[model samples]
Target: MCGIVGAIANRDVVPLLIEGLKRLEYRGYDSAGIAVIDGRDVRRVRRTGRVAEMEAAAQSEAFSAQVGVGHTRWATHGGVTEANAHPHISQGVALVHNGIIENHDEQRERLRALGYQFESQTDTEVIAHLIHHHLTQGADLLAALQRTVKELTGAYALAVVSRAEPQRMVVARMGCPLLIGIGEGENFVASDVSAILQATRQVMFLEEGDTAELSRDGVRIFDGNDEPVERELHQSDVSLASLELGPYRHFMQKEIHEQPRALGDTIEAAMDVGFDAALFGDNAGEILKGISGVQILACGTSYYAGMTARYWIEAIAGLPCSVEIASEYRYRAAYANPDHLVVTLSQSGETLDTMEALKYAKSLGHRHTLSICNVPESAIPRASELVCYTRAGAEIGVASTKAFTTQLAVLFQLSVVLAKLHGKLDEAEEAGYLEELRYLPGSVQHALNLEPQIALWAERFAPKSDALFLGRGLHYPIALEGALKLKEISYIHAEAYPAGELKHGPLALVDANMPVVVIAPNDRLLEKVKSNMQEVRARGGELFVFTDQDSNFSESEGVHVIRTPRHAGALSPIIHTIPVQLLAYHTALARGTDVDKPRNLAKSVTVE
Candidate 1:
């Protein structure tokens, strides 16, 4: 993932552009750059490191202007060098882009035939040249942008500033996310609201194939066909304090501790009333009642959230459920039932693969669609027929902590609602579940209280080369998530398998050098899980377990145990996730790795 920030105001915007890029550092980028329309010329500065380097480089230059664009580039088409940095200039036009261009090679050849020269080996440079080519043929900036986008393929969120139109900046989006921030005598544009939240909370999310023209006076929007369009400007509810790293060492650590609050906010509305179908949308109750089954689509951590939901839906609602990786689902000829509810889960809601899978499913006559997402303005929510907004706020860390747990909370709520709708839960049963739901935040806090003990375990794991995580029944997905967290932040080779599946294959990888993490919740499968632990111990594998307080598990030579407060009846998965997150956080701390922004990973996967 890359980031783009643009501004048009009455004052010097170089500082604003730089600060905005700093806010987007969580999105993960290698090189950073900025371009400003300084008087009659488009002045540019580029750096091959963090945004701080770019900011320092810009401080030395006299590139002061009222309009500018900034970019944080994650290498996709070329090497991570200063030359490949964005604000790729051609003729009088300078632009920064966020997504891939599929037709860049052909366009480059055509532009070369027309005597256009290239500087960087980037598909983004082609856009600059294409726009310049159009401007040379007597088209204005907006017209040139519309015409250039018409000839390009694939996803992109572009912000361009031109010397020909020094008073304004033009931005366009096709597949990737883009939004405009409103202010007095100024306007801002960025890939996410966090980038511009400091400037203005009032923002308008751009729809697919929409374009916008920003100026010091105001902002204007247009569709792909050059027709003027109107979009609602909504005020964002994200507090700037939520984005800060208060006393914690990193955002991941802060987010791990913030789980109690995040889960509370996510499940507050559904805790007392079970779940109101009307919270989704109009006719949502009818849609939920009519669905024969569920088909869930997601990627990465969100996919694991769906996998956990599959267990809850089938067991509680008594309906079959299937979970698919969105990327694989779109490429194959998968069977779709019109009566099956299609559910999509994502944090940013701009996940390209998941969005495409939803579209693919809809094209096959899967009429019922629901999106459980954190961002309300994102494309997935707009494309969905019903939406369950996860109040997780803005998750800044590349390794998701609060977002994943909050999503699990939402998914559990959906499961309870479905079970009640299907007549599986009577009044007493529903009240019991509601009481359990109300206590989930406290359960999460209880798990967090074990962090001091978990940190000691992390010290043992930090020096290890590999890890294996095991869980039984509904906790299996929790095991998978635990392994993913370890591999993502600590740079260890980690794998997860069902407790029963250890004998099948993964047991061979277990030894003293490998740490095996087991999630034991004292459910019906506790006895079976205990047997699985014996197999690990017999193989001389180091075992670290997170279980309920009432469990018989205790510390031994190779066995380490951290007990939670109590067993949450149906919401155990949500509580079980906190210790695993803290384990990864403390382990990464012990290894001195970048716990928040892991290498080769971004907070949001906007590109395929």
Candidate 2:
């Protein structure tokens, strides 16, 4: 993922651009740069490290301008270097881009044939050159961008500023996200609203294939058909305070502790209104009636959430359910049934693979689409027929904590609603589930209270180079997530498997040096999970187990036990997630790794 910020205002915008990039730091970046139309020249400063380096350079160089664009680049097409950083300039036309250009090689060749030179090995530079070519042919900046986008293919959110047009900026969105921020006598453009939260909360989220021109006076938007269109200007609800690291040392730590509130907020509306088809969307009830099965499309953590939901859907709702990795789903030949509901899950809602997979599923004649996402204005929700928003509220850490748990909360609610629709649960059973749902926030808090103990276990885990996480039944996904958290932040090599699969292959990798982590709730599978623990113990593999408080398990040699709060039955996975998150956070602290912004990873995967 990359971030873009642009501004056209009466005052110098270099500071604004730099500050915006700082805000977008959570998106993950190896380089940062800013280009400004300073009088008659396009001046730029780029650094191959943190935004602070670039900011210092801009300050030392006295960079200032009324029109500018900034970028935090997460390398895709090239290695991380100053030359590969964005705001790439071609003959005074500077541009910063977010997504990938699928046909960049062909376009590069075409531009080369036309005598346009390249300075960087980036798909973005081609766009700048292409636009410059149009400008040389007597097109204005807006017209040049419009013409250039038409000839290009693939996902991109681009912002262009030219020396010839110092008072203006042109921004476009195709597959990646882009938005325009409104301010008095100033207008800003960014890939995410949080980038401009300090400047303005009034923003307009551009639809796919929409382009806009920003000036100090006003903003004009054009649709895919090149016709002028009016997009609803929204008041962004993201609070600047939420983006801050307060008492917590890292955003990840703060987010892990915020799960109780996040879970409560996500389920608040459903609890108040009572679960119904209408909770998802106006027509979700009708869509639910027609569907006989569920097909989930997601990536990374969201995919794990989907995997957990598959068990819930089949066992609780009695429906055939399948989960697919969004990136792989599109390339495979598969049957798309009209009777199956296509459900997409994402935290930011701008996940490129999942978005494209939704389109692919629709092209294959899937009749229904539902998006369970955190951002309401994001493309996935706008494109979906039904939407259920998770109130995680701007997860800033590159590694997700509250977002994943809140997604599980929403998916569980979805499961209950579906079960009720199919008559799988009567009133009393439904009421019992609802009561558990209401008490989940408290259950999650109890798990959070175990953090001090989890942190101690983390001290034992930090020196380990590798980890294996195990679970049984419904918590298998939780095991995978636990492994992911450890590897993601702590930089430890980790893997996960169902406890039953220990002898299948994973057990061979276990030994005295190996650290084995297990999620053993007091569910029906606890005894089976305990038996698997014996196999690990027999091999002398050290075990770190997060179990329910009422469980009979106790500490012994080569075994570490951190008892989580009482399991909430079906919602136990959500409860068990808290301690693992704590373990990862504290372990990363012990290892002195960046717990919030993990190396070589971005919060939002906007590119395939």
Candidate 3:
């Protein structure tokens, strides 16, 4: 994922770096660029596609500068062209990157053996020719970006701009996400806070090996022994008018109607401070009473919200959970149970494989991490020791609805505070599961009032191409997050089994033009998900269900039911994920696609 923005200003910082690259264009829109400096030289503008075509090619040049840097790119080592865009300039420095400089081919062969002539197969133009080869040997610009980030390794979040330091803007981060943004005379830097949350909600958030410079009067930070630190700004309740789309057509239907106010502000701060396994660390109730097992990691819809919290932490935190998939748990080498309580999940806790799988489970000695994120200052909650944020604000839809129902309402309030700290629920069954999480935002507003009956089954699934979803015990990760929100915004070709694995082979790809979609939640797996929806209506599959009106499944002909007004026992996967996120936002608004930037997908993966 890419998207960066920087500014140092008293004025024309190229329209605040093109409105913070159009609010971090959902973290990467193929290509876009900007550089600025100007007086002493840098001034650039590249483009390949969106950021409104690089803001109409920076209004055909003469990009007035007050110091800048910007980018939008999502290309990794190189391809979406305008010569692999980004600010990536060289001699006069100018940069802009988001992760993956993985030893940029041995530092681009030691800056091409010191003659440095590369153009654009970018590892971000080899960090602008190794910061113009350490500012042409006499190191300056923050010691040539701290000696070209100590000769680079992996994951970055750079932002640079020099032209002999025309006012300033230098940034860095090791894993990914960067921040800053306190303004007035002007200072920013991004990678997201919804691109400086419309210029300043007083940020900071740059931790893992931080570095900063930004100046038109503030931000200094540096550490990783470059010393001078101090970072804690924080005033961001991110509201660019709740990221607008006011009457909603898409920010995925204004985050599927802001999932009942983002699951009532993520379980209303654990129902106002009661559910506590020490609210996740004051030694989290002595690590939830020495939690024996439970891994999680995540990716994609937070790995189906850690497979629906491994069925609520093994059915109400009796423990023994598992989940993985943080980019295959950081290249597969297992058995790291130093009292395994490692958890992760990331709405944009800069997920570079869930922050390298929580630094490979803290290098195999796990020591109880936790992150259930929504950016309490990213990098997996600053490399997790404990966190739970998921306020689920600012999702900016790259296919995630209210951050997967506020990370399943913070993994069902960390499985009811680890099932009441492992006695497996006491105190009136944890006050009846905190009064069913304070009545789960009215059962997710009765599943967003079944979005006009799932938009009348998304107008019969917007001319279906293929679909299947189904469910069973624990609604099979809510039918694999409703076939990954209908193949992430209706590219269709969906699938999801576990309705007793549908004849162990996906019922040979169900017929009558697919469309099975069950998740019939009434509980005890509703007659084995109604005999797997009668084996997808005895083969002419075309059922749809999403049940709950006491699930005696109805709608006669080929079966279609919509239900979901009540029965959310054990909080039915956050109320059946709001009618599977309004049937993938009304089937990607009936196939017009781009349901909030869904082509190649990039809300935040922060590069592999």
Task: Give the best candidate by lDDT.
Answer: 2
TM-score of 1: 0.99
lDDT of 3 at 478: 74
lDDT of 3 by residue, 392-463 (tens): 787787888788877887788888788777788878878888888888887788778768878878988889
Candidate 2 residue lDDT tens string, 111-194: 999998887889999999999999999999999999999999899999999988887899889999999999999999999898
Kindly list the per-residue Cα lDDT of model 1 for residues 1-608, writing each as its tens digit: 79999999999899999989999999988999999998899899999879999898889876689999999999898998899999899988999999999999999999999998877889999999999999988999988999999999999999999998999899999999999999999999999888888789999999889988998898889998889999998999988998889998999988888888988988887764556776567788989989999999999999999999999999888989999999999999999899999999999999999999999999988989999999987999999999999888788999988889988888887887888788877889778888888888888888888889999999999999899999988899999999999999999888999999999998888888988999998899999999999999999998899999988887999988899978898889888989898898899999999888788888878888
Best-to-worst TM-score order: 2, 1, 3
lDDT of 3 at 267: 77
Q: What local lDDT does model 3 show for residue 495?
A: 77
Question: Candidate 2 — which residues are off by over 4 angstroms?
Answer: none
TM-score of each: 0.99, 0.99, 0.37
| True-structure lDDT of candidate 1 | 0.91
Q: Candidate 3 has what TM-score? A: 0.37
Task: Give the range of the ten consecutive residues with the poorest summed lDDT in model 2.
Answer: 270-279
Backbone clashes in model 1, listed as residue pairs: none
